[model samples]
Target: MTAELNARLEPTGERWTLVFIRELRKPPEEVWGALTDPGRLERWAPFTAERDLGTTGDTTLTMIDGDESTPLPATVRRAEPPHLLEYTWGDDLLRWELEPSGAGTLLTLRHTLPGEDGLGPMVASGWHLCLDVMERLLDGEDVRAVRGEEAKEHGWEDLRDRYAKMFAG
Candidate 1:
């Protein structure tokens, strides 16, 4: 992927918000299923929801892998099915907005960090790859979740450098 398609970061007071916009060749409903359905999420997302994340409810999102596999508490701030879904992942807030665009869906992901941290590039790179995997899944490609070393081996470092430059200034 090119740097132009990379996530864009904006300084919001003490916090930094990253926005990733992708035009998918699928309907909003299909994309929404991939985002909220645990089965589909496991194919690409870093975590899996304990409960159905399709409504305005609370759920536990268990990290796929980590030193401590503790489930993080998450609360749905907004859920409008196939349109908008906002939730809190630990201290950060993630908002996904979907709209009909031509024959496809315009998906926008906004992740707001609690503060300006040097980990922005890494996080952006991870999400960049995650989104790419998600898109490939939607395109009927059987791709598995890529993280940690697997991510680095899949050009994540290059993405991280590009994202760092984009977020630098």
Candidate 2:
């Protein structure tokens, strides 16, 4: 079978990275709080992450879907209050960097997945959706409907295109 396209931005450079940046309407501390809080994660993404909102280390994010759940074991590599948070997601290094953007906060997500065994596209899609949800959550808007619409529109072709573009760029 062929590989899937990315759900968000295409990969770039030799690093095989998927990067997404969004300016949250809220301040840095509020944005950071939302991201760190596990209860807030579920409201946006379809996962329940278990970890200390203040301390960062080895944390497990269990994806919630119906009655099933998949535990994604990860380790926090770095953490700086209301600024930066970097972690390992499977074979990829996921980094969440926040910056002051006027009265709002600019949040950038960078994911680096090594190798090219088709995992890049898969993870990109998830990040895209999660970022969308995060955006909605920051705006205090309902994200379930938005996620459903995005899934309906993109599907797998989007995933493959994302990877192909990453390879080309």
Q: Highest lDDT: give the candidate number.
A: 1
Candidate models: Cα lDDT each = 0.84, 0.67
- Residues 47-100 of candidate 1: C-alpha lDDT, one tens digit per residue: 888877888778888876544465889998898999999999888889999999
Candidate 2 steric clashes: 9
lDDT, candidate 1, at 4 = 43
Residue-level error in angstroms, candidate 2, position 169: 5.1
Candidate 1 at 98: error in angstroms?
0.6
Model 2, C-alpha of 152: deviation from truth (Å): 3.8
